[model samples]
Target: MVEIVPFGVEAWLNKREKSAKYDISQSTIASLTMHEVLNLDGNNGQEFYSMLDQQKMNYGWIEGSPEFKQEVAKLYQHVEPENVLQTNGATGANILALYSLIQPGDHVIAEYPSYQQLYDIPKSLGAKVDFWHIHEEANWYPDINELKKLIRPDTKMICLNNANNPTGTILDKQFLEQVVE
Candidate 1:
């Protein structure tokens, strides 16, 4: 069994969220009701009842519904509807991806101070994980030169967060192009 460290942000939220008047620590937007979600999906609020009556709501689709997958594919350059996947959430997606890719003795470079899962899962998988520091001094972006230095011949994977999570520092396309080059 893998031993993962406790997630502090969740703990803090669980402990402090109820009492806190203005919660800046809330990572996502306020929770929405099923009706609000259906409305946002461009359906009438009553669609939830229609869905429950017409479709099986007991379980999720294996690869997501064709309609949902097609919508997801539209967001990417060349992704196909058949190739698009749906996970439970971001953390589950990260776990699935990291576990699938990283093997023992592999070299992985993950952005420092990003989501803990990005670095932690790879390290636990027996990969030699390197941190690509993103500091405020050079702005939030990791130094491309530093990245170049970190890449070894044995490097199996490079983990980059387009937007560093806690800081919400985004790496734009031109900077990404430089990294790819």
Candidate 2:
């Protein structure tokens, strides 16, 4: 029998031990409810209730509504609304991008001590995943030279997280572009 392990976010959430001493891992809805900050009349609550009240959900929009896509497109100056295809969240978007772009046996480089999903999903897809470790001593940013050394002929993808979880380190655009180049 083959042993099946959970992938991506599920694996991270299912961990028996906390990843950090101060990790306050919990449900967002439950936390908001406890704090009394989750008002039903708020933006999401109102939209959610309106949808629920609809006589027919009817899959709503197949690839999400054009208006919704347009709104999302506004976030990027260069990206058009037609390019937007909404998913469950950022995690879903990341998974979709990886699944659509990455192939088996491709080499991928991912930032370390960040979101496990960033690297794990590629690995699960049979990609040879390499880590670019962020040193705590160096304020959690990986050395540029170290990253340059990791890039090779087989490298197909590079994954990173902005405002890295647990550590909360944000990668600036300049550094990100350097990695891209």
Candidate 3:
């Protein structure tokens, strides 16, 4: 039987909590408390809380509200409101994208040292996963020539982390063009 693995950062964070005083492992910035976050609007937080207080205490939308989706769709070109999907978080988005695109026996190449969910989800779905390793000596970027060598006719998807999670390494325009070629 096949089994999925725990998220790398989450697992490491759980273990690190027992001993580490400062966590530098994850990419996310320090979280803001609700009060601190709400106060950022400069209205003493009443307007936002009042809106929430008046909202019905029920599921707002199953596949996101039309208005919410519309607002999201406005940010993109040629995308309709119905095409926008609201997910719980990054993990949810990753899972949804992977599940929708991958099938058993499909091939996937995921850039290494990213948030593991990129590759792990596809692996859990039974896709053959190959790592496009980033070279530390070359500043944590994947070599385009190496990527060309790894591609197979069965390759269904290629995953990349824009500004990679922990190291913040970005794939530049020239490198991206080379990959496209």
Which structure among the candidates has the greatest TM-score? Answer: 3
| Per-model lDDT | 0.84, 0.78, 0.88
Q: Candidate 3: give the clashing pairs.
A: none
Candidate order by decreasing TM-score: 3, 1, 2
Estimate the TM-score of every prediction: 0.86, 0.77, 0.89
lDDT of 3: 0.88
The Cα error of candidate 3 at residue 90, in Å, is: 2.0
Badly placed stretches (over 4 Å) of model 1 are 34-44
Task: Say which prediction, candidate 1 or candidate 3, comes out ahead on lDDT.
Answer: 3
Q: Runs in model 3 with CA error above 4 Å? A: none
The C-alpha RMSD of each candidate to the native structure, in angstroms, is 2.4, 4.4, 1.9
Pairs that collide in candidate 2 are none
**Residues 1-181, candidate 1, lDDT per residue (tens digit)?**
5666667777888999899988987557799886777787476756666767887657667878889999999999999999988888878888899999888899999998888788878888888989999979877888999999999999988888666778878899998998888
Better of 1 and 2 by TM-score: 1
Report residue 121 deviation for candidate 1 (angstroms). 0.5
Clashing pairs in 1: none
| Per-residue accuracy of model 2 over 1-181 as CA lDDT, tens digit each | 2222455455666674256555455323333562244255566466656666885857688899899999989998899988999899887899898989887899999999767777877887888889999999988898889999999999999888877765778888898889878
What lDDT tens digits, residue by residue, belong to model 3 across residues 1-181? 5679987678777878659987777666788999898998799788899888989989679999899999999999999999999998777898888989999999999999787889888898899999999999999998888899899999999999888876799999888778777
